[model samples]
Target: MFSEPEEPTATRMRRARATACAALKVEDAAQNPIWGYAGRTLSGLVHGSEEDGWLRVVSETAARAGGRLWEGPRTASFALPASVPRPALHRIHDWTEEGWSYRAELYAYAPASVVSPGPVLDTDLDLSEAWWAGLGTALDALAAVPTDRVSMREEYIRRAVAEFTGHAVGGIPWSTAHGDLHWANLTGPELLILDWEGWGRAPYGFDAALLHIYALRAPETANHVRKTLAHFLDDPAVRVAELTVCAQVLQAADRTPFYAALADPVRRYLKRMGRGAV
Candidate 1:
């Protein structure tokens, strides 16, 4: 171990982080660690510099082993374009400790900071044309690949789109997506995508629509997103993708007040498309 491994605690985030650090042969970064959303799965992440001078990100995720969530990141790490501008996975350590399956992943630290602390983009970003080009290229490349998993179930897509829009959809264009795409999972100044734990196939333009939904509160940013990913967002075939994401946000809003703000905007958007009777 490069550092003394802390005792594993099933409930505490730091314990998992420390254990992962030790297993990955890394120490804590200069700054504090970041935690993901509070959920049934307990997880935490921190970054540090490796002996090789490359920045290393160590994260511990608690979930059932042999499932999609358990395998997504490791699968994406090897499957994605390594030459692209994103963190490169170097090593991984997974084991069952304290009656829970814990996965620790070590990735080359992303080159730029995340655009937003939360899923919603609350502020404007002065992204360059080159940045937009890079993002388009990356997303395009990602969409071209095939995958075994799926981000959204075909049955769910059909139900949600029909229930939300009062219109049925056929031949929904399916493609690979980052799945949980939002400003929080993207970097500023550069376009390095993060958190690949949910990557899988979905409706074409799903990623862009998700990001755009998050940016609705920030009109300038929202418009900028539309302008940038217009190729995906503007196509008539992408209506199902847009409706699918909006329905998801509406459903989430119903469950928690945190997502409430996005619900009305999505409703209006659906209504404008001659749908949204529901």
Candidate 2:
């Protein structure tokens, strides 16, 4: 079978940075440097620009839920109010410079990420119960606010779960979620969620479910998440959320090593859920 060649990282980074600089009106800024690079997007601190901020440049075709979550691609983010503890957005711009199109979002820079970006985090957090306490705090804060954003409904979950296990789950609760909740998008030494492009209303326990799914690689961490979010996860709706996320990672196992590692545990989980033993 033939596969398309992946674009070289250096080439992608330079193009992304160039688009970011142009859109941010800081094309000549000399202090700019790459802070992080996920597959289709790159973020860095901007300098010599009229405004001080962190810039995130992403490919246009990338699946971004921010548009619906924040009310469109050109609009500023106001849905996440002060209590959420996320970076404040400064501006947003979308355009096709050269042949490829892009969307650039500038935000106030955050100090650091809790763990390096990837499927698994190996850092010894030496975290206290207070750190775990923040998860519940953040989720409660998010749930208190209502939004017109799109819902991450159970039908989607049912389809995804059915794709793998030939079973469907229904009637899950819905609420706003940090759609891409995972260690990579979180910063610590202090808790700050990064990468808002996917924030929107999702299944009620979706964020914690995704986080726990990722933590399955570390049983202790997974247990910690389960215990902390037990208030919500105890709801049957939330169990469906966990199963939905597991189905997703299991379905995407070929693309990343992280998902590959999740296979067995997810399979075990599905089996239990299927038997109504969860």
Candidate 3:
């Protein structure tokens, strides 16, 4: 269908990206291609004579890997409300070459710059008052937009909450969420949430909760996020969102050294909440 040669993975990813750009008829403007977890996706910038956009390429070794879900972000621009602060999708190219499937999306340029391109935020961000206000507005507007897309399965949420929070949950207050609200997916000075592959309905306050969890290592900033999104704090749904995010991070910890720091903070958080995860 499309590309990994490592086992040739990195090389295959790059070649796949180049071929995608050529097929899409865009010029590569980035010095380097940004890679996703384990190099499953590769992304860079592309430009024509007068226009520029971010070009992202994704590969799957199997026909059913992520299936239809991976197309959410690629098509999100056409459906999400204008109030949502995100780039507009310009074009998409999908094809099968050499037994691999590749899908490339070119989106209107993202302005300002990314806050952090990693899952964890170690530095304290001195975000502006306007930026904080904008984040709140964006989250609120996003929540109001209705969608049938499922970010996390109902059964998965029940099981994860029970496993991590040590309690059974019912009647979750659902709202649209970016699903992945880590520092890596956010931009600042101005607020622009990126990478919306999993945007869909989730428990209330999910975005705020996930954002807080990622900032836990930077205590001051984490506190700032909670304070900024205070309306979302103290809700039962938010608490569930928090612990569930903790479970996700803990799972990531075992695989990547960078995420290992998040596990202790999660345990401390659980203890504070009077719950213990076995």
Best by lDDT: 3
TM-score of each: 0.85, 0.81, 0.91
**Over the full model, what C-alpha lDDT does candidate 1 score relative to the true structure?**
0.71
Collision count of model 1 = 0
lDDT for each residue of candidate 1 in 165-257, tens digit (9 for 90 to 100):
666777888889889888777887877887787889999999988888788888998888888899998888778888888878876887665
Give me the displacement of residue 186 in model 3, in angstroms. 0.7
Per-residue C-alpha lDDT of model 2 across residues 172-267, encoded as one tens digit per residue: 677888777778767776777766655667777888888877876677877787899887777777876787788788888888777787788888
For every candidate, C-alpha RMSD to the true structure in Å = 4.9, 4.5, 3.2
How high is the lDDT of residue 65 in model 3?
A: 50
- Stretches of model 2 off by over 4 angstroms after superposition: 1-13, 22-39, 48-52, 61-76, 121-124, 151-154, 274-278
Q: How much is 192 displaced in model 3, in angstroms?
A: 1.2
Candidate 3 per-residue lDDT, tens place, 1-278, comes to 01223457898888888898898888888786677766788887888667888899888865665543677886578768877888778888888878888888888887677888586887788889888888888888888888888887778878877865575676777888888877877788778888888889888888999888888889888988888899887665576677677767776778766569778887788778775432
Q: Which candidate comes out best when scored by TM-score? A: 3
The better-scoring model by TM-score among 1 and 3 is 3
Judging by lDDT, tell me the better candidate of 1 and 3. Answer: 3
lDDT of 2: 0.67
| CA displacement after TM-score superposition, residue 192 of candidate 1 (Å) | 0.4
TM-score of 3: 0.91
